[model samples]
Target: MGNGTRLGRVRGLGSAHEGAGEWWKHKVSSGSNLLLTLWLMVSVALLPAYDFATIAGWIAQPLVAVPLILLVLSVTHHFRHGLQVVIEDYQHDESRFVLIVLLEYFTITVRVLAIFSILKIAFTTTGVAA
Candidate 1:
């Protein structure tokens, strides 16, 4: 419950109790990102061609689109968590909060755009046919 024999323990001042959860999340996201990225690479490598329409049509399938979206989510989550750790560890200036805010906003915006593009491709062409 306490860190070492620091006197802050008796005064009820100690760890914030948030690091473990954050660490777990980073690990989970990292694992998912690895698997999803490999899936993406294999899927693309097996494609007949890398042309735009061909790629878009491939993404049009629900099976492909869902995993692609998941990849985006996992990558962005990993990205933000990694950067936030850097900012938290090295950024001691007053602007740290601002940087964190900007990081969150950037991550959210990227996630939204990526998901939108995938969904747009997935829903185009036909409702049931890819």
Candidate 2:
């Protein structure tokens, strides 16, 4: 016997049991993204100047760097999850697998580049030229 209605079974569709987890992850990332984005906007708004030195100095602070990193991670993960859903829904067969793998690689590359940029700025010595 199957877990769905007789009609559903006849139609060959069944519960995947995976959507709940993905939904929760999307909700959590969206919430974090909201808060962190607000923080980023306020922080930037309060800055005395938008010059490279000022921005770099601000990012170098541990307090700033940590949340910035969190924001980067949340945004990237959210992006990947959303795109994966779209690809899975719209694409078919082998192409779906290919698109998903490409999406994963693209998201990973972007996250790595973002985190690396943050770390490079955060750890660099003060008074360095841009």
Candidate 3:
């Protein structure tokens, strides 16, 4: 028989078999977030100036754009995963599914917007106006 108590077996409320994967994902994402945040802070601090032109030129670099995209993606994924855990634990059954769906949509929307902005800046010519 399964390791759970008799009542757990009777109620069929045992493990869903997904928690470990989610936990590991959260850990990895947290680590990435720390590193990326430090990178962003140091990079910005070292910048010659924060004007539109200077910042745009900085983002236009391949190295800067790639890490910025990674930072956006990692942060959003971690956000959604963390919120999903909270919603699953505290939210009522009737509302949990809805909240998770909404969270996913919000995360995706923000991530896409940020990535798109980075890509636009990375690919555009420095001489272009607008």
Candidate 4:
């Protein structure tokens, strides 16, 4: 009501018009994670064996690989969002920025390694060692 808008002086007000998008993203990722987790359990349960050959062959299929990749991405995103809210809520000091940055870097690194491993197994592995 003074020389600036409420957000400029109120601090943390109105969500900076970003809360809805972040909320929706978090919820969507959660839903995807649940569905993919169910798929994983059922798929593995239906397998003939839990051996390396059996699992590798299953992941090599396009249908399986795609969903597995999606699951990885979704889980990574959900983890990031969940941690971000925690950081935002409990951390009020300047360290919050550093923590958030580190969180993002960590999530990215984990996601890349996970996806790469999945792809490698799906494409390069021969299912079982000779």
TM-score for each candidate, following the candidate numbering: 0.82, 0.81, 0.82, 0.81
Q: Write the per-residue lDDT of candidate 4 for residues 35-115, one digit (tens) a residue.
A: 999999988888888788878888888788899999999999999989999998999877787999999999999999989
Q: Among all windows of ten consecutive residues in candidate 4, which has the lowest summed lDDT?
A: 7-16
lDDT of 1 by residue, 1-130 (tens): 4374567655435576888998999999999999999999988888988777778888898789999999999999999989998997897766777899999999999999999988987877464332
Off by over 4 Å in 3: 1-14, 127-130
Off by over 4 Å in 1: 1-15, 126-130
Better of 2 and 4 by lDDT: 2
lDDT of 4 at 81: 88
TM-score of 1: 0.82
- lDDT at residue 53 of model 1 (Cα atoms): 74
Ranking by lDDT: 2, 3, 4, 1
Task: Point out the higher-scoring one by TM-score: 3 or 4.
Answer: 3
Residue 33 in model 4: lDDT:
95
* lDDT string, candidate 3, 1-130, tens digits: 5678978756545777888999999999999999999999999999988889888988888888899999998999899999998997898655887899999999999999999999988788476322
- Say which candidate scores most in lDDT: 2
Worst 10 residues of 2 by lDDT: 8-17
lDDT of 3 at 106: 96
Judged by lDDT against the true structure, how good is candidate 4? 0.86
Better of 2 and 3 by TM-score: 3
Alpha carbon deviation, residue 11, candidate 2 (Å): 16
Candidate 2, superposed: residue stretches over 4 Å from native = 1-15, 127-130
